[model samples]
Target: MSLGAKVAAGETRFTVRSPHAAAVDVCLFDGTAETRLPMTRDGNDWTLAVPGDLSGTHYGYRASGDWAPERGRWFDPAKLLVDPYAIELDRRFAYDPRLSEYGADTADLVPRAVVQGALPVVPPAPPRFARGGLIYELNVRAFTMLHPDIPAAQRGTVAALAHPSVIAHLQKLHVSAVELMPITAWIDERHLPPLGLTNAWGYNPVAPMALDPRLCPGGVAELRETVAALHAAGIGVLLDLVLNHTGESDVHGPVLSLRGLDNAAYAHEPNGALINDTGCGNTLNFGHPAVRALALETLRHFVRHCGVDGFRFDLAPVLARGPGFDPAAPFFAELAADPRLADRVLIAEPWDIGPGGYQLGQFPANWLEWNDRFRDDVRRFWRGDVGVGLLATRLAGSADLFGPDCRSVNFLAAHDGFTLADCVAYEHRHNHANGEDNRDGHGENFSWNHGCEGPSHDPRVNAARAEDLRAMLGTLFASTGTVMLTAGDEFGRTQHGNNNAYCQDNAAFWLDWAGRDTALEDHVAALSAARAARRAEFAQFPQGGEWLAPSGAAMTVADWEDPASDGFDYHVGGARHFRIRRAERSAAI
Candidate 1:
């Protein structure tokens, strides 16, 4: 809240926090000209004030101090560093070798943060998304890139989401909230540009608050308007945020914002090497008060200014790690105590590639977690690798994982893995296009090819795949607790086995609206309607139920454990019944 350019009555105040810097300067840009104003140091903060409201003015910062990378100090005044609290940018970040060069002047390379005036704050309201509703996860750009109804100019931006066609599609599926993948500004990995690839997923963020100009050129107002429109249509908006790391990356990486202003913002080993908890070069030091403050302000900014219902944190374990992940971390306690964030829907992608990072069900009782176990076990079940017992356990809310409360967000597939359609059509990942020698995505996907790999022209193979797709969708809807369906999955979108399509910004990743499988979509719509009609039963684990065999008799222990057993009928409270037959590849409620 105390950082970045703030415009108030009759004047504008520029503030930045750089604890290790000897001095800091506010660089103002005007077309082809520039002016640098010295800021007075106040403790760890640098402050400057200019007469008149400087709203819409472009600005950046330069901090001068020790330039020791090995010792965790990277102070470079030549680099035009972005404001850590930047709310908007005039351009998108582009990766360049000069950005990482110590003495290179990057004023022409880095984006300038635009000074914003006072924004209209949305009135506080309870989130539209409920704990047990459907969350439709999507990549904003890829989701609408090929939509026929959206105007060409708006196809790949946030404003496109407000289109009538998009809303109608979401309504058809009974989506409670649309979990938009990262819309914040991000930079491509250093290795990507040369390979003619970009970060299609905005996970490699530098400025936490700034919205990417390419994605939302209208900035805060654009997002606020889209949120209002979705809310009007009975859908909530949940932003997927990456606060764990920045694109600044390792010591060999660039000196953008935090890295240039205050290297101490990143977690470092005792000997001064940067910690790689996020597998993204650097891990933010949440233990630092400044880092925590920036995170809280970022969340509040979205809720207060943009009216977003909640957030789903990427690599969430890093937020709890003060060197090691702690369920009782201060960040959790602080988040709960904050009046603005306390009641918001908080979901965690509860794992990272760090030490002791797999803390699946260890989040706060009030929080929900992404259940990869459900994803894997359910796939294994339909593939005939697991018996009915495992599938039943997942359908019953994975009490073994989440205890009695069932705080699981059960999903069949998400944006990071194979699509629901691809799961039935490809047994192996095809990620050669990622330039990683096909070793990028998960090798073992718990998938099957139905006697053929990739696309098969055989009618029988296609029929089998379609049936399996419906079976998985049925199982997801029948499972207890919250459920999420990745966009394009409900209608059979495929990436041709490219499980890791983060770098594929081409048509391969775009949803083919014209070619969608309507029959499968209709089946999903029916599944949604059925779940909604019995919302109470699906919202929680059944207190009492009858597990019946296909012959209309009670299921015995032998039936549950038998590998050959493939189907069961569950009757809940003598009112709601679920029928699932793996042999027939059919499930109905």
Candidate 2:
């Protein structure tokens, strides 16, 4: 059954799926007044149809059944539950202890699904993503938060991204796609408000289908319009999604939506303890048929209604965890078979903190994965490590890891870790402002501070840092797979050494366009133009292309094993490297 409130000719239908609930009713709210309509049940689905137009109605569900957390079945009728398939929300959800308590009726404290008319029918054009192109990853809010050209009212919002100034920056760099960090409806972690912080990354999603009001107040239509604007400018959009876990935290966490309606939707141990595979309290049970259906529907809604070009799944191993990580998981098969999504770009973070979690290069051939091996090897090479041969392999493409059939998404820095500037400025993470006494971020950053730990006024130290930064960016663009650059890295943005700045929704996370390193910016642009011409060269080569040495001779095992080698070059038959090469200077531009 199609879930959520759908309106048609003079009739409106409501449907919900919960296998364990004994009884269910749809709750309609108009200020302090409420109307409860009992729904007819057929197996796992509860549905009802009314004969009048119910287009802007605020609605939720109330299920009556047992409340036993020890056995993982908590169904409290008093707690109003938001529909999982809702396309619109009346407002953003605010946290309250009473909303999850056993006997309290908290109807007024939750967000309701709006009974929307029909979704627009603007089909997406053929995907703009090709074999090898640049991907610029950015947060919708932080990217333009400090831009002076955008209107004051539009700053830190989705509407600001569609501004001509923002699009022009992307066009100047020849960006093939803009991968926006998670924009789905999410909540701050339970401990952040008291610490005077909020979740800036939007990774902890509450509603997979609904966009966060703080990010996009104009709702789905606003996002659709933004997508259209980017498409007209010849740039594609990719959404980072959190499908591994919900904002409803641990056992002591709140029962906002999924936990309130059906605890069975989440993964559990044989003893009924919530499986914490995501390291984010609880994980979704992809083995369940209903849970799988919910994930599928969420993907389809974004494609059919939002017109997105692709998705990057956070903690992707959780989706394929059947006893352990399996490349042939049901979800992977479904994605390959779906005509609407097969051609669209699909990327995976490729690892989690669960058992057998580090399954890099193990995903199906159809999906592109984040190559952490590439990240580490590139960092070590520029940091003056001794393994030049290893760096050569990564630069050519991690053929040893992904095999010849699969492609990799090569990136040196992302949102979770330090920015590219911080990678060269701090040897260790500095996260004391997170209120955790600098104990929250990763311990091993694989960075080098050149001379000093933080900012240095010494000209020699600053000069050395700038050269290393150029070399890192140069190596990334000179590779063979798709490349992603953090939004502020082009101008050398820094988080002041805070590697895990997820909780800092302040200036530390926002991109400051006012002060930028213009020289580094130009060098990045030059590298991008060089990469654009190189991508067409690589694409012309057939699968299993011929490999050769820099002297245009055949490559050998010993040639690949030479540890003293600095760099090697190969041609894709007739394809050639551009003449605009990096110089051995502090200021390469």
Candidate 3:
């Protein structure tokens, strides 16, 4: 019996792609009693006519095979498997070695969630706003965990997104979108377990189709309500999707959902063992037909079923990379043609931590990419790196990177790095607090800690830092790419230089709403509004922008500064804070 049909509430139908397992059994648990039902084989798919209706039944597949650790054949019949189509979860997973035959801790993991009804019926995905739309990237738990205004029950849940206080805040702020960090099911690393840290920025995805129950108070309904409310407020929701890899870490990793389903098909490999190209171990192989189908299925699931406006692919370069890393891989072409996904925003991280993997500005038309170059260039310039003398190109639109083909997802900071506050204040990564002895986060941050290493009492340094924040944030709003705002970076959120706060679910990652920085907040609100107005003006760019500089001739700093030069700038600049006028007339982009 296939897990999908079983979860649809009829007699369970099971299928397994593995021709290797000698025998397969579908075991059902009713809390008190356990029933073992043997499956009849048809090729590799086993048919089971289980007698019972299971709406919320707990189950696992028992395959006949030796528990051979050497050959990597781990078939434990005693272990209870989770329903991949389960609409509801049994309970929050705790990292425990007992969960698997091996003593590795896979607890804080996502129990295989179900697809509920077969084929997974979903509401139509809404239209995606343009590149100029504002995105508020945040952790669901941290967004409302400590808010005073959010109801106690709703705090830190998907319902918190629609809470009056949240709505009031986002609506008042005038942000066009909100990006939830890893709302998909995820698992925390074993080392983070003792520190009581969780997968705060959920890169470890357990189920691509299912929402992490931890983020929703009333499960799927609550998540649906949150999405609806955000739409009602005119805010589009973008999910941070980890399609480059899965929750399963390595061969030593646990037998999680995807690993158990189709190991060879779904993951990458070099010399037979799964390749850890994403640095998160077990990269999903989009090269495989079944894996590609799963990837397409996952996207369809979100677009049609989840009602999300778009997806931000984490480590997206791998998705485009094929047999090796090919920018124009069939995977991209397939998505580009998928009518269901064609309209929704497709934002890629554009690079993976692998050899020959960093592909920027290479994606097809209509896709938006996270421009790491923007972040690096902006940091280098603000830090007084004279090497960054050529930012006028980037500040203008990064046409060198994304060109006219695709728009860029530009920003100064993201969830995986130090917040803007830390970038200007701390010279090195401060991850000792992360329990990895300061060896966890990235050290090559291209950051310049102006006159201090962490927080300082010096007014000169602090004021300069504030100005730098404004400069970067200002540059982001001022640019032509799609700006993705890391949750509290607007108001000087600091991870104390802890770039990777995937764990540390506490205040380290959460937005401390009660403790507001009035001045920075106001400045951000104004800057964001200005950026938005300019974006609207330049919505249909090249089409809207008047030519300031000719294609062959170099645009100089003097021309940019000289107000007297008939040289008007195409950019509308900020609403009030700044303005630029171009000399010649050109079409909008």
Tens digits of per-residue lDDT for model 1 on 1-589? 3788988879899999988898899999998588999999988899999999999999999999998888778898999999999999999999999999989999999999999999999999999988789999999999989999999999899999999999999999999999999999999999999999999999999999999998998899999999999999999999999999999998888889999888889999999888999989999999998888899999999999999999999999999999899999888999999998999999999999999999999999999999999999999989999898889899988999999898999999999989999999999999999998998989899999999999999999999999999889999999989999999998999999999999999897899999999999999999998898777778887678999988888999999999999789899777546888999998878
In candidate 2, what are the lDDT values of residues 461-492, reduced to their tens digit?
99988888888887788677788898989999
Consecutive 10-residue window with the lowest summed lDDT within model 2: 580-589
Name the regions of candidate 1 deviating beyond 4 angstroms: none
What local lDDT does model 2 show for residue 485?
Answer: 90
TM-score of each: 0.99, 0.94, 0.87
lDDT of 1: 0.93
> Which lDDT tens digits does candidate 3 get at residues 1-589?
2334353345545554444566777666565465678877777566576545555565556565556644546555544444444445655555554555553333233353332434334556556466677778888887788788888877878887887778877865677788887776667765567886767777877656566777763666666667888888888888888887866577666666545544664454444676777898678777776666667767776667557788888988778656578767888888878988878888878887777778888777777888888888867665545232344556556777766643877788888888888888888887876777888878788887766788889998887777777666666676665677877777787787787776787765677776767798888888777666657543433443333433323346665454344322343332122332222211111
Error of 2 at 220 (Å): 1.2
**Ten contiguous residues with the weakest lDDT in model 1:** 571-580
**Shift of residue 17 alpha carbon in model 2, Å:** 1.1
Cα lDDT, all candidates: 0.93, 0.81, 0.66
Provide the RMSD of all predictions against the true structure, rounded to 1 decimal: 0.9, 2.6, 5.0
* Cα-based lDDT at residue 265, candidate 1: 91
